[model samples]
Target: MASASTDVDFNKIVKQDQTLCAICHFSWVQKDARCLPCKDKVHIFCSDCLRQLAHNDESHAEGILFCPVCKMAHRWTEEGVASFPRLDLFNSNNDDDDDGNRLRMRSRTFVDAPPNHTRSYVEEIIVSVLRNLHNQEIQMIQKINETAANHMKKVREQRHKLLEEVLMFYDEKESELIDIIREFAAFEKFSKKVGETNKKVTKMKIRLNNKANSCFHRNIEFIKDSSLADFSIGLNKKEEEFKVSKELCRLPTGGRVCNTSFFNDTLYLLTEKFGGSLFFYKLLRYQMKTGIIESLHEWNNSIKIEYKLAVSVNIYLLTVGEIRVQRVTETEDDDGKFSCTFSTFYDIMRRKNDTTSFVHIIGYEKGIVLCCQDLDNIFTFKKIKDPVKQKWKISLNLPLLKIVDMRINSSQLFALFTENLHYIFDLNSGKILNKLKTSTGSPREVLGITKYRFCTKILFQSGCCLIGNDFVRLIDKTEDGVSSWSYKKIFDLYHTIEYGKCSEGIIAFLILDKWINTVYLKYIKC
Candidate 1:
């Protein structure tokens, strides 16, 4: 072979062996090798060189080895061999297979490996979760703080507002007290002056007593011939008249009449026949002086009238727990006979099953106002457009209970009780202005009487004559300063006599005599 050898081309031979190891300069025909991270023709790695490189690395405990040239890591076995195999360039001839192998190589280099749950990846995930939890905690704390701050701000504002209101109230109270103190000082000065005047009067009274004593001794001899007659006379005038039966007027056709009212110089009587119908009654109207009773209207299918109030030509009759407004109209025919017609009934209060509970019914303005027995409450109804339609207007809760009678005077409503206590209320404002205890004790009945107007009064007992005693006193609110002026001696009634409604200058009284069991009307001059 040496004798036949010619000049050999070394460059050609080197070029023919393209698949060789770049790390050891070994041919791929004798040793196993892999492409390095560069993946070029000259940069190929042999297994032995890779083993030696992995053995010399400090990070090999992680089961991975990396190339020194490109710093690309590869998975390595415990024996310091590359676990991922590379395609041999000298064996493959299929283009598809070569493309697939290149694709796999690129995938293995770029794609992530199996998750290392025990190392830095898990620690990083834990750190990120902790960071999110910390942020959420900070956000919650901020929200809570904001809520607390808002609540505190509201509390402070409310506190300041309440403080201002309290201060204003105290200032007003102080001003009132100061005015009261000034008035009290003036009252004390006047009282001292009155005391001095009273002392002088007492001295004069002592001198008068001495002079009277001397005069009595001087007139003792002269009184021997003078006669002293009995001074008690006419003390039982009304008492004597009550024992005798005095006829006021003849009885009407109706069986018996109890409640009566006088309006516009005419007497209105409520008469009901006994044992006929318990709930029906006949309303009779009679002239004051003529005494001729004629049937004005009959209340059929209604509870008997208990209380009534007449004002301004309209008669308010309370029957079956309802107050009705009745108006009488008169018309003259060609025959000169006067025909009267009653107006349609206006329903004010239609309480169910409360037929006999009414204590008083007062017509105020255009509505009906009432107070019941044993009830400390009062209610008012207003007149609507239609007479049949009425609405509740005012409801007042009174401080004093056991109200016996109530009267409306202008803008004030006066309520009287059985214990000599009276209350004054504002009609428009529904506020109780004052409650006063009168000097009179335990009134059986209280009548708010005047010479010009109709007022309220409780029904008096039979044979009761309110004479000489202070029955009622009109209080002048302007000058008297809530004190009553003088008691007005109104009237004295006989036995079984009851006072009825009063208008301007006249009042009516009904007398039920037991002699005939008949009802008579007595026209009283006011």
Candidate 2:
């Protein structure tokens, strides 16, 4: 037979017989005959078809190959043809008659294959198979990467959310802690205040108890002494029988008694004499049984005599001089011979050139208060050691319009004067803290002003004295407005007795006439 390559159109053969071996069909191609063992025979000229057939026939190692036209099994080998076991075919037996169903057997003849053959169709098939595999692998890798990236992004978002939650929790915890601290501080402060209040209440209770006990003792004493008190009625008396003797040292010529004070059962009489001479007399009450005459111990010239006596207590006598103070004291002796002695003197006069002019003494402990026509000043003394001397310590100036009378109550001193003025001053500092004006009667000439040590009663002259139907109106410069002075009428004439004690509720102004000897005792409660 002529060469098939000369008779075959190679392009038409390759397109028509895609499953036929190109070497068998006589195409100018190199055949991959090793892939033909599983009977997946195609054109060897198409390399793409060969590779595809080889991938589909993985059982080629078992050595089974078949030719489509000849229907014959062949052995696959790269070098030479090899023998392989054949599959058994069924034979028609004598039991079946030759009807139209008789077996139609087809015969195939094997041919010897050529080696080292190259086919263009085989090369194309191999290249196409590799390209398809590469494309599939690339698509799978892209999907895996996308999945991993998505998972990482989700993890980051979760971490951020967790951090936010932690911060919020911390803030809440911090707020709660701060609230607890503030509450604790408030509790501490409240507890402290409660403790302070408790202490104050305890102190107040102690003071109240002390005051109650003192009042109780005073009341008991008053009850015990009530019986020994003397009671007299009316003011009538025999003036000639109970008379105040005139033998007592009379006032010096051209002098008058300005003020007087009784202390330590002795009398301090201050007399204003001419030439600014002050006659200070220490009067002792004569003991009727002793037969010793009570006489004036010492006499001295004072700076001025017109000043008022502010305070007189025990042996300490404070006298105000002209712009100075004369403090006197009695010498200490066991003989009981009452004699007045001069302690020391100090000058407390201020410079007249200073514009800040103040001259008022409101209170004193061991000092003098100088009472002028419209001013008052205090001078205190201090005892000096080493040389053993007393000196004027301090001076307090106050606003007072003629200190008419002053009474002490504990540490406070109440001073009454003209212009209806009343000043309450500190006894220590002599500084006035309160002032009041009386609505009615003027504190003009205080006849008998008394202050009960145990009571809050102040008694003063009202400038009105009644002797029966006669009203003896005394004219005086008082804190109140001025008024005319006269007697309303004259009643029965009577005698008078001037001796009295302030402690007695009733002062017996004894008055007696020829008709009856009745003692009119005026009972003043305060």
Candidate 3:
């Protein structure tokens, strides 16, 4: 009978290719439901379906569950696993060697009689004990189920209290924020008249947060009077955690400033000369400590209609229709003589559009590396040769197009796109490491971004500061070691930001006061 039943079940599985669950009555593609060893073929759709049956079978309240359809005890676990992971299978006292004194796991279906005992007498004694043991199991499971229900009820009540506490926390934080805002508004209004008399805000030396770059130990707090404020994300909301914004100096140019770069503590600003000037453009190097023009030179004939400027250590590389490296000796004072010489450094031409491109330079091992952005791709050129007649050759290429901003470290490149995306590329392997969209939050430590349509980047001591129309996001590239690195954002927001540059942790932005239609150079520490 068993053989005939097994054959019929096999044929049904082979021909129909599915089985209907005995518990749920659902068709499944598995060869057969996990069933007990029985002549009658009973199907259990899946492990979950059988588990539901075991949990709800009140008849087994204090005993082991049996098959619902066949009422036969069998292995319910899935194939290949020895036991369920949640079960505690350890035994302090083992019963592997039996001397007819105690019945064990196998004694449920078959008993082993000792040689000294009569078989019939042994069988009668074992059957009587088995009935009593089975009743004990029923009582144990009933207590277990009752304890579980009572504990779960207590946990649910506590969880409801926890939810209420969380909501209260959020409400308290919101109220405190409103109070701070009111306090700042009143203070600023009171100081309005005194600020117009003799206003002078001295720029302070900005210190870099040389701490490790991980979000594990940060306490995030937002504080902005205007926009989605700057979070002084640090170990604590300490006074040193946040930066002070002060007036640095009014820009030398009243017309406008463009293509700005900062290296060391010096500021390099490109200003166009208008209204009867000898040159079309003038590049000024201003010292931050003295607020005086260190050097001013005519840079008209060397650039095209459009150009980009980058300062690396002491070398200044400019690009537009051509690439020029500003002579390092330009730092020396001429007394009265003016000598601002730039040798044409644009030699390699990979494409026609490469002539007019955005350029950035960084000091590599011995020479300098020139990073250029064409219409289709980004090409990096290494200055392989020495001092005499320096030449730039193509070193590597990355097929990342529409890069609005590019910031380079020793081993990685942070490339930003106008489409609200940013990519980090491993320069050593020329492979993309990570890609992320500019957003305010994420699953991991969400480094923030303010992806305006027009955004630019300026490198700081340990990171790159991304500047937009009103928001600034700092990308910290602090490597845990020389071989590895991580990203962090010290984000802030402002108003009417036109151009920006950073050195160490000091940032200077040319902000236009829309109320008065005037521009001011402001400095802030990070």
Worst ten-residue run, lDDT, model 1?
Answer: 235-244
Q: Could you give candidate 3's per-residue lDDT for residues 1-526 as a string of tens digits? A: 1111121233223223234556654443332234344546544345566667766775434444566676665443332112222111112145563312222221122233444766687778876787577456656666776786777776577556555655665676566556655655654564564463332211111111112111122233333334312321112121232233332455554434556665555567666645453336666676666755644566454333555566553445555535454443363455764456675544554455444353665443234445655545545544432353344344333454333545555334434333345555544444555565655333122223433222222222324444554444444322331111222232222233222344324253433321111111222222
lDDT of 3 at 331: 38
lDDT of 2 by residue, 200-263 (tens): 4333332332233222222111122334223211121211111222221222234334444433
Candidate 2: how many backbone clashes? 49
Against the reference, the lDDT scores of all candidates come to: 0.43, 0.35, 0.43
lDDT of 1 by residue, 44-67 (tens): 567777777777886777866666
Q: How does each model score on TM-score? A: 0.34, 0.30, 0.40
- Give the total clashing residue pairs for model 3: 1
Pairs in clash, predicted candidate 3: 62-138
Q: What is the lDDT of residue 126 in candidate 2?
A: 63
Residue 507: error of model 3 in Å?
3.5
Kindly provide the TM-score of model 2 when superposed on the true structure, using C-alpha atoms.
0.30
> Native-vs-model 2 lDDT?
0.35
